[model samples]
Each structure stands twice: as C-alpha cells, then as structure tokens.
Target: MVYKMLVLNIDGTLLQDNGRINKMTREAIEFAQSKDIKVILSTSKNFPAAKRVAKTLKVDNHIVSHQGGYIAKELNKPVYVNKIDEKITSEITTFLESFSCQIKLVHEQFSLGNKVKLPENILAKVVFQRTNRFSYSEQYVDNLSEKLQEGPVSPPKIEAAFDNNANLSDAKKAIEEMYDEVTCIEVGDNKLDIVAAGVSKLNGVKYLCEQHGIKRGEVVAIGAGIDDLPLVQWAGLGVAMGNAPAIVRSAANWNTRTNNDNGVAYMVKEHFRKQYKLEFLKKINVLK
Candidate 1:
C-alpha cells in the first residue's frame, strides 16, 4: 500500500546513539519527501528541541513535541497546545521535589527546572540535547516550586529523571493516583514526561492526520521508546529500530537496522524504492 506520511521519533529512531543524524539517513528522508510524502517528527522533547532537529534536517513540516502535548509548524503559531494547569503545575513540581530526581517545567518557549547538584556526567544526560537557541530558553533555580509560586505557569509538559527505577515507579504511581488530569509517561528506565491526561504521541499524530486529510492507514510510524508503542502499533506501517526494545520490535510490521547503523535510511530507501519501481512499471503499462 502507498503511504502518505512518515512519522519519526527523534532520539533513538532518527538520531544515532551518539546523538547525530547520519548522512545516509538524511538522504533517505529527502528521498521520501521527493515522492511527495509528508514527514513529521514526533518526539517527547520540548518544541524548541524538536524544531532544532527539523531545522537541521531541513524539514519544515509540523512537529509533535512535549510527548504530544504541543504541535506546531512555526515557533509563534501552535496548531495545538495541551498544557497542565498553572496551579496543578505548581503542585506537581512541588510533589516531585520530594523524590530523588531532577524536575523540569516545560513551556512552549522556555523551561524552568530545579537546580540539583549531581555529577557533571549525569547532568549532561538531562541537559545536553538538541535545542533552538533563539526560540527556546532554559533556566535552573534553587527550587522549582518557589519559582512557580512567584508566577503561575501552564506548561505543556513536566520532565523528570530519577536516580533509580524504584523512585521512578513510586513517583509515577503516586502522581497517577493523585491527579486525574495528568498522566506520567515513563520514557526510559528512569525518565518520565508528565503531560495532560489522554495526551499521547499517537493522538498527536492522529490530529495531524485529520488536519491534513490523511488516514491512519496511510501512515508509517517509527520509534524506539516505550512512549512510541501505541503509534508504532497503530500506524499502517509500523517500524521499530534495531536498537528498539524487543517488545517494540515484535510489535512492528518491520524492523530496521539499529540507529547507529542508519535504521531510518534503510527502511525508507527499501520501502520507497519498491513504490518507485511500482510507479515506473505502471507508467509503462507493465502492471495495472
């Protein structure tokens, strides 16, 4: 079947483990776009971070960010925004402070996080990722709750990283039991992204599809994280990176090479190459 859109996850699916997009992957994305396919980047990162990657790849399409809490094509104009209430934002950050984890209140244009003393190496993991310098700003404080109390904030997402799985699990459960309006998504072993309830990467992409008159059955979704499972399973063509967890791979319609090996490039080339061939055959009246 012919696909109209390609949805991608940024971290482990589009970027290699070292946090760079390979040349082959870049060209392959271009190839798909050349076929008039719309490619959308669906990521758990904030808007600015996702925008930076799109700008780097030269993809100007709308992006799904903040774990599907925000969707925008341009910095100033948001197609959609699902933000946590300012009061709830304050309470959530306040509660999260008790846990042994770093907390970040993610807004559309800025992020306010708590200043937690930790080794440089560990800090790098939480802070050093893709960012758009002009459109996004990040500030750390002695206390996030105090910062919020100074001014109410309706952020699109709240992010946290725990020191261990036990803390992660307990925090997730406690948050769920306490708030009916929010949902905590465990993005990794000990990382969580909290957003409004019913907000998900799948629903975000679905909204985009509806806006563009595309159907769920005419989309290709690729991802590697636990947060990616729903979309990966629901897309017309679901692909898992070789680096994806075993469960994700098993759920996918196809599995490509690891991110380090240019998984995206492999899948895109192989899939579209066949489509191109079929088109050529039909043009020559070789196949109906």
Candidate 2:
C-alpha cells in the first residue's frame, strides 16, 4: 500500500539522543516532502515548541500538540481544541497539587504554571534543563485551581511531572478514578498529561487525515513512547524507533534503527526508494 502521510514524534523518534536532528534524518524528511507526502508532527509538547522543530524542517503543515488535545497552524490561533471541562479542570488541578508536583495548564499559546522549585524531583530537574520543551511560555501561578475556577477557560490539558515513574503512575490512577471527564496519559517516564477523555495522537492523526482526504490505510506513524500506542496501532504502517521501549516496539508493525543511527533515513530508503521516484534533483537550476 502507498502511504500518503507521515506522522513524526519529535523527541526520541526523530531527534537523536543528544536532542538534535541528524543530517540523514533531515535529508530523508526532505525527500519525503519532495514526494508530496503530508508530514505532520504529533507531540506531547505545545504548538509553539512544535513550530520550532517544524521551522527546522521547513514544514508548514498543521501541528498536533498537547498530546492531541490541541491542533493549530499557528501558536496563538488554534484550528481545533478539546479542553477538559472548567469545573473538572479546577478539581483536577487541585488534586494534582496535592501530589507536590508541578502542574502546567496547557493552552494553545501559553502555559500557565508555577516554576517547579523541586530540585529533588527528577522530572522537575529535567524540565528545568529543557525549558523550551513546551511550545508556549510557562507563566507560573500560585493557585492554578483558583485561576481555572476564575477563568472562562479550561486548558486543553494539564501536564504533571514527578520524581519517579511510580508516583506518576499512582497519580494517574488516582486522577482517573477521581475524574471520569478527563484521561491521564503518561507521555514519558515521570510525566503525565491530562486531557479530555479520548484525546490522543491517534485522534490528532485522524483529524489531519480527514482534513487532507487521506485514509487510515494510507498513513505512516512513527513513535517511541506509551502515548504512541493508539496511532501506531491504527495507522496502516507503524514504525517504532530502535530507542523505543520494548512494549512500544511490540505494538508497532516493525522497528527501525535507533534515531541516533539514522532510523528515519533507513526506513525511508528501505521502503520508499523503489516505490517513489526522486524528482527533486531535477528541479534545481544547476550550473556546470
């Protein structure tokens, strides 16, 4: 089957372990774009952060961020969004605060939250190291629940980070049990993103496909985390990064080399080199 759309996950799936895109990966994406495949970035990050990556790749397609609760062509304006109920958001924030975790309210443009001062917290430390991880500005608020209660808005999602995976897992279980209006998804080891029930990267991918008139069977998804399960399973062809955990790899159709080893490039060359012709080389006005 011919694939028309390629869904990319930024962190571990596309970028190498040191947090940069490799030359081979960059060239492969350009090659795919030359073939007219719709490339969409699906991430747990907010739209702005995703935009930076898109800019690097020169990709202008709609971005799927906030774990798929938010979608937009630009940072300030969202084309689609699914936020948790206002009342529930307040309740959820209140509950999350009790866990001594840093909570960030994820909106389309700016995230409102307090700076995590928990140095002993592993997630907070990583978050500090990667302040640009989220696509929006993080505005710290003392009383997030009160702020949510006072506002006419409920954020698309709330991401809470902890020191350990066990704490996050427990928090996820508790949050799920307490509020049926939202879904708690563990995007990484110690970070949990809470969004409206049923929001996921698969939902984001489905929306993009519908907009582009593509079908599920014509989609190619790549990911390397717990949050990637749905899209990996739904897409016609799912590729897991070699750096991905065994469970995520098991869920996919196949595995590519680790991102550091030019996994994306390998996948593209192995699968598409024969199926699709490269005409990009002919378009350049070369002088002999």
Candidate 3:
C-alpha cells in the first residue's frame, strides 16, 4: 500500500547537535510537502517546545507531545489529552520523596514546581545523557535546596534524570510493582518518566489518526529512542535513525542515516520516488 504521511520525533530524530535543524533536513521536509506528503511531529517534549520545531519544519499537521499523552492542532489548539490520574501523581510524588529525587512534572507543559534548579551545563548534560540515573548524584541533590526555594508548579508528568550507572533498580522495581496503576517509561538509558497508565506514543498517534481520518498503516513513524518504540511498532512503516539504539534498529522496517546526515530527506525522497514511479506506471498501463 502507498504511504500518505510521515511522523518524526524531535530531539534525537530531527534536531542534531545543539537542538538545531540542519539545512539538509529542512529542505527534505519541504520537498516532502511539495510532493503532498503530510508531515507530523511526534515527540516527548511539551507542546511549546514541539511547536518551535514544527514551525521550523513548516509542518501544519497534528502535533503529538508528552510521549503521546497529548495531541494538538497547531500547537495551541489541543484536540485531545490523556493525563495521569491525580491519585497516581500523588503516589509517585510520595515514592520519589524517599529517594530525594528532584522530579520535573509535565502538565500541559513543563510544570513549574519544587524541582531542583539544574545548572545550564547540567541541563545540557541531562538532555544529552537522556536518563534518570543522575538523580542519585550528590551534585544534583546539592542543588535541590535552591530549586525548592524557587517554589512549585503542579506537573502531571514527572521526569528524573540521573547519571549513567546510577543504581535505579529499586526505583524501576518499585514502579513495576505499581504497573497496574502507573506506567514507568525509560526515555533513554539515563532518564526515567512516570506517566499515568496507558498513556504512550501509540495512544497519541491513534488519537491523531482517528481525528484526522488517517489510518495506522498510512502513517510513517520515525524515531530514535526507547519511548518511541511503541510508535514505531504501531506505524504502517517504522523508520529508525542510524544512530538509534540496537533495539530500535531491530524494530524498524528501515533504518535511515543519522539526523545530522539528512536521514529525513532520504526517507522522504524514497517514499515519494516509489509513489511517483508507481503512479507513472499506472498511467502508462491505462493509456495502453
């Protein structure tokens, strides 16, 4: 069957170093639109952050954010949202308290609350590390008092970043034990995300498809993280990045070059080249 649209994850799959969109990638997305292929941005980032990237890509399709818990039209007009239950949030807060972990909760966006203020350098490292293992580091904890002093905001989503090799077995085990009520998703090797049960990238994609009359098989999902596994699995065609984890590569139907290498352009060109060729063949047969 012919594909109709493309879905891309931001952080690792679209943006290269320093969260900037490379020139080749930008041109590729524009070319896809020139071919009438709709492009969607599916990311774990909040709507605001995703909107910036979406604007850069000139994409007007549905935006999937919060790992699929929230979907909006044009970043500001939300059509659907799947938030974690309040009780679950309370329980998670209590659970993390024991470990003294500073969690960033995401409601509609990054929830402002008692989160520890991480230095810009540390924040950069956390984004790069993509894990929750850093929560166990003394340095992270040392900044907690300053973070708490800044006050709190209610976040429906909670994220903890820790250094690589931090022992998080206990946290993982605890979360698993409560799996029936909460879902603990690892974003990368070092970051842990706890959202309400049944909220994931797959759920968000499904919601978008239903609202837009797009079928699961008509969409192409591209990603490079553990959180994107479900989306890749659910898409009609799953395209993983060359820099993706081994597991992600194994799961996708095709593996493209790294984002910095213009992977998006390659896939977009391939999709349309095949489509145009097929259309050309069909016209030829009809004329005969």
Candidate 4:
C-alpha cells in the first residue's frame, strides 16, 4: 500500500545516540519529502525542542509533542490540545510531591519544575535530554504544587523522573489509582509522563490524520520507546529501530538498524525504492 504520512519519534529513532541527526538520515527524510510524504514529528518533548529538530530538517508540518498532548504547526496556533485541568494539576502535583521524584509541569511554551537535587548524570539523561537547546526557558521553584496555587495552570503534560525503578512503578500505580482525569505513561526507564486520560501518541497522530484527511492504513510510524508502542502497532507500516527494546521490535512489522547505524535512513530508502520499482513494473505491464 502507498503511504502518505511518516511519523518519526525524535530521540532514539531520528537522532543518533550522540544527540545529532546523521547526514544520511537528513537526506533520506528529504527524499521522502520529495516523494510528497508529509513527515510529522511525534515526541514526548514540548514544542520548542521538537521545533528545533523540525527546523533542522526543514519540516513545515504539524508536530505531535507533549506525548501527543499538544499538536500544532506553530507555537501560537494549536490544531489540538488536551491540557490537565488546573484543579487536577494542583491535586496531582501535591500528590506527586510525596514521591521521591522530580515533578515538572510542561506547557506549550515553557516548563515549570520543582527544585529537586539529582545526580548530574541522571539529570543529563532524563531531564536535560528534552530540554537541551530548547528555545523556551525552564523555571525551577522550591515547590510545584505551591506554584500552581499562585495561579491556575492547565498544563498539557506533567513529568516525573525517579532514580529507582521501584519508585517509578509505585508512583505510576499510585497516580493512576488516585487520579481518574489523567493517565500516567511510562516513557522510558524510571520516567513517567502524565497526560489527560486516553491521550496517547497514536491517538494524537490519529487526530491529526482526521484533520488532514489521512487514514490509519496510509501512515508509517517509527519509534524505539515503550511510549511509542501504541502507534508502532497501529500504523500500517510500524518500524522499530534496531536500538529499540525486544518487545518493541517484536510488535513492529519491520525492524531497521540501530539509531547509530542510520536506521531511519535505511528504512526510508528501502521502502520507497521498493515502491518505485513496483510502480515501474506495473507501468511496463510486467505484473498487474
């Protein structure tokens, strides 16, 4: 089947382990654009971070960010958004303060996080990963729930990072049990993103597709994290990076090379090449 859209995850699928896009990957994405396939970036990051990557790729389409809580072509105009209610946000932040994790409330433009001391290494890997080179400023306060009390905030997403897996699991379970208005999703190891109930990367993409007149069977999705599993399984061509975990690879229709190995470049080129060859053969009446 012909694919009309390409959904790419930012961290592991597009950027290499070194936090940069490979040259061949950029070229492949350009090639896909030349073929008229709209490339949409879907990430757990806020818009600015995603925009930095989009600007690099010269992608002028809508972006799916905040773990699909926000979708917008530009910062001021949002096609869709599902923000956590201010009251619920306050309650959740208060509840989360009891856990041994760093709490952050993410809006479309900025992030407000609680000041929690963490190891330099873990901070770099978890919090800083999405915040690096971000155009928006991040403010850290002594308390997040108290900050919310100053003013009502309907943040699109809330994040919690834990140093221990046990804490992460416990926090996720507790949040789910306590709050019916939000869904806690495990994005990576010891990291959870809280969004409105029923919000997911797949549903985010689906919402965009509906607005653009696209179909579920006409999309190709690539991802490496557990948060990406729903879209990977739902897309017509679900691709798992070689660097992806075994479970993600097992769910995908195809598995490409590792992020460091130019997985995205390889996958995009191969799929389109086969499409071109099939079209040529059909034109020549070799097989119909």
- Best candidate per lDDT, number? 4
Worst 10 residues of 3 by lDDT: 130-139
Q: Please write out the lDDT profile of model 3 over residues 122-180, one tens digit for every residue.
A: 46656622222222111133333344435433343567665332534578677779757
**Whole-model Cα lDDT of every candidate shown, in order:** 0.87, 0.80, 0.70, 0.88
Better of 2 and 3 by lDDT: 2
Residue 204 Cα positional deviation in candidate 4, in Å, after optimal superposition: 0.9
Candidate 1 or 2, higher lDDT? Answer: 1
TM-score of candidate 1 to 2 decimals: 0.92
Model 1 misses residue 49 by how many Å? 1.5
Superior by TM-score: candidate 2 or candidate 4 = 4
Q: What tens-digit string does per-residue lDDT give for candidate 4 at 159-273?
A: 9988878888888888888889999999776789999988889999999899878889989999999999999999999999999989999999999999999999999999976
RMSD of candidate 3 to the truth, in angstroms, is: 6.2
Q: Give the TM-score comparing model 3 with the true structure, all chains together.
A: 0.80
Looking at model 4, residue 41 earns an lDDT score of 97
Q: Model 2 clash pairs?
A: 49-135, 113-140
lDDT-based ranking: 4, 1, 2, 3
